[model samples]
Target: MKKFNIFLMLIFIFTTVFTACEDKIIDTTEDKIQTSIKVTHINIPYVYNVTNESDITIEGKGFEQTDSITFIPRGGQGGGTIKLGIKTIEDEKVALENSPYFRDGEYEIRIQRGILDQLLGRTFVNRIFNASIPDREGMTVKGTVHSNGQGVANVIVSDGIEFAVTDQNGVYYLPSAKKHGFVFITVPANYEVSVINTIPQFFKRLAGLASATEIKDFELFPVNNENHVVAFMTDMHLANRNNDLTQFQSFIEDVKNVYEEYKGQNKKFYGITLGDQTWDQYWYSNNFKLENYVDQIKSLEFPIYNVIGNHDYNPYVSANDWLGAAEYRKVLGPTYYSINIGRVHYIILDNMQWLNDGGSQGVVGERNYRDFLDQEQLTWLAKDLSYITDKSTPIVIATHVPLFTNPDQNGNFNNAMENTSELLAAVSEFTNVKVATGHTHINYRNSPAGSNVYEQNIAAVSATWWWTGATSAANHISRDGSPGGYAIWEMTGRNQQWYYKSIGFDKDYQFRSYDLNNIHITSATYTPSATDEFKGKVAGYAGEFATANKNNQVLINVWGYQDNWKVTVKENGNTLPVTRVRKKDPLHIISYEMQRLNANAEPTSSFVTVNSAHLFLATASNATSTLEITVEDEFGNKYTETMVRPKAFTYSMR
Candidate 1:
């Protein structure tokens, strides 16, 4: 019995031992199911200012549409796990700035791909080291890192110099480097540095005062709080009939995009169209139906104002200046008007009959143009100005014909104006004024009247004149450079900022202020020896009203070499209005009733003539009397033996 009992005990003990060993073997087999993933690399952690450090960006190839990344503090204190939020495939940016669950400490960043309904994807685990960087020498460098926490091996840390790649494990060491320093990775392709809290482009190196330097904390630039105003328009000329509707619609869409971006902002913005709203080149018929045009504009969220361009009135163009004033009034509200926005007032003037007189067309001669703004319109303007006396109000004058030009000094085609004296007189009474126009399919800005009145001539949206050439005078280039774009004006305090961005020219295109700082009265001068042609030079005042008061009697000294030339005071080309105070002395106290005269009359054949013996007279004084004078040409272009004055002025003064 004793022998049998002993044997049974031995058997039981053996069975127990064998079962325990089997169980242990099975547990070890199950543990092998979870494959350990080796983190191939951990990029440099993004470092923003250490103070408000919040958003953290960790980029790598393993992230997917539905992956969850959890961040945990490696050793605890002030650390916690943060789950990654939804990821977007577009823009490819992970916004971690708003996440509040993470703490400042060494963190274990682990990402797991694929979830409940999907198959397994890759997994990654990385350690993030956060430490405060002190100022050294004259620089302060803030830094962060990702590693396996062991002596990081095979790691590379660069002060942008002397690259030091680590050993086998991912370990990096930034040795005591320069005082004021810069450190950036020699990032291999497919790898990106942490760009978070840094400049927008992260791959670039990091820079700052060194650890031993006394550093000043960086203060972020103030945000732009000023409201933005964008002027939008399309189908300006309706160059080609077939292309009109599409171009018009596209313009409205572009404007809509601008309005959508700044809808809630306080800056009030709108659009303006300089008529021709339809293609009217060939047919007297309306370009695209007006209903369609209005529908397109109504699609825009902002209000739009229109001015009748020539094409809009081509129906009556043959009669009295294309579509006459009565028709223009019926089609697009008033031909001229005014509106006020904020402290700025805008005056819209109609200049369709630009060639009413026999002078050059377009920009050069103003007399040839029909009574552009009729007497009725001029009266309205005076009334408008009477109400607009506040010198503080900024005024913008808009017309189809730009009032200034940089034309070669003698070009007869320079269509600025024959009667601009009246306009300048009216405008000089105000403090802040600007003028804008577009008839030249080019982008040019000039202040012929006065630089203080910012004058801008926008480029044409359509390159109709030069549609086929390798090089055209229109000054247009490729698509981004063409199909044209608009200007964005932003006002902050008393400063007016202008930015011209081409269509599709990157979202960041901005208007640059070109040397407008030292703008003051002392920087300019007024001169009385100023004529349409022999305008005397005024220092620092390129485009200025050279007016002198007779009471002030500021003498303007002028010199003429030849004889038969006598200088005298006059008004509107009339020697009658001119009071002869002194001869030989060019200096004269300018009376408000100032007349323009020249030693001789240079007859230009290019100008249209109403009669056989005459060219259009620009000033009224020369119209009454046939002023006979010797004509001379320095270039020796054919000169008539003697120039004869015409019987009548261009068109009777409007």
Candidate 2:
């Protein structure tokens, strides 16, 4: 009887262990199935009524009860995740409604699930036509979105408050409300609106909408080729100065000359201006004068895309953030937009935010400037990028202010975008991306933390704010001593190459060099100072050294220097190591000092010098021999300049 009892106990223990192991295997398989959710189809209307909530249904596989739906509205309205009203988890179908606050515009929807933070699927929806009645008798506005003379369907067209999607024939219509001046379209992927006179022709004014009915049609061209070239020029800052307009004309001539060369190669060329098209913002009272600048830019025959700068804002406008760009929108259309060229996607964003402080101009006084991209713009960016099917496509982001830059000694970031991390995060999935900006009037390149993307800060065309010193050789010299220049980027397949072109210099003139002896300084002796007194002395010393002996170190500023570029100094068939140093340009210091000592200096010559990132230093032996400097830009273009070492001079200062 004892043996039989023990046998029963053993059987019970073995049965329990086997059951536990079987349960573990089943759970593991179930978890794998749960996470393998696949979205097959989503049933959503192309357009919705702004005032009415419509049911949205999504169909997929492996959706669980833990999954949630999120709707992101475009045009600056932030969206939130929605509570599932009716869900069939087993069928993988979920239904939700548009948020009550959703306006008449475009929106994005996403399916999210699990603690691992996964996005199951995403799509876009457009809320067409205004829900509210028009203040005045409504006029029917109709238009068709066409690409290459063929109607393109499902394009979103809007009049700020009301949006409509083009039908199968690419035709759309909306009842125009009172005070609606323009009817524009959210340009579709792979197609761009007609650009006329450097201004994007995406909208038609209401003046042509006489008698309650207007017919407007948009023409979009294809830029889907693999080889294309883009010309980036910024900070024209055109004003009523003595030579400002003439300088702009000369810059245009240079662009024409360059474009002609590219045209000969049969390369497609596109032009983009980063911002600060006018300096009239200096007098906030004369905000209307911006119209003059707009007209002048519109006179350019080529279609030069533009982004908004702080100087483009109307200081007197007292509206909210969305309406703050009213005047700019009236002239420049959308402040943010996107276009596609070949495998490259280009996005232009307006990073300037109005403070509503009624300040006279930008970059003056403490707390004068703030950089931010409104939540709406961020939402738009996400939605726009979603439509892109190619994950490996390269993207080019252009804005007026740099998205990333080094802060000042006080930990202040006056020149960089405050939300850089967020922007970088949004584009992190894109492997090949670059940002181009113009505002500092200095040329430099920087890559933000957490990403390998590079942001190139192109120098201004109106260098030193149109300030030309009487003794200076060039009318426009940036405060950092970089010649006023623009950048030309050539994209072939997945590869891109760029070079900075100085306004009056040859294409090969990528950098400038100086004799350290003439500047009377070595990297060891040169110290950066913030005090006004010391700065004044340094400026004077630089001016005096320009005419002194030239027998010491060689300093070179490669305007478009990047980490990949190779710079070296050779003397007597021996190569010397070059040290990268943060030093202000000696020529810029001399220009500033000359302006201070000689009151006859041009008004634009008063710019303060800032540290240059591209400056390289190397010492040479005191032998009077030819010092050869060689620079190879990232594109493999080699530039060489030879300077003769001068005899050492001994000067005794009393």
| Candidate 1 wrongly placed segments (more than 4 Å) | 1-235, 239-242, 264-266, 283-292, 321-323, 354-371, 406-415, 449-451, 465-483, 492-494, 507-654
| Cα lDDT computed for each candidate against the true fold | 0.39, 0.66
lDDT of 2 at 97: 51
TM-scores of the candidates are 0.38, 0.67
| RMSD in Å for all candidates | 27.1, 25.3
279-368 in candidate 2: lDDT tens per residue?
Answer: 634534333345667666654545677788877766545334455566666666678777666678888887867675553335222213
lDDT winner among the candidates? 2
lDDT (Cα, 0-100) at 191 in candidate 2:
61
- Against the hidden true structure, what lDDT does model 1 obtain? 0.39
lDDT of 1 by residue, 580-606 (tens): 122111111010011111211222222
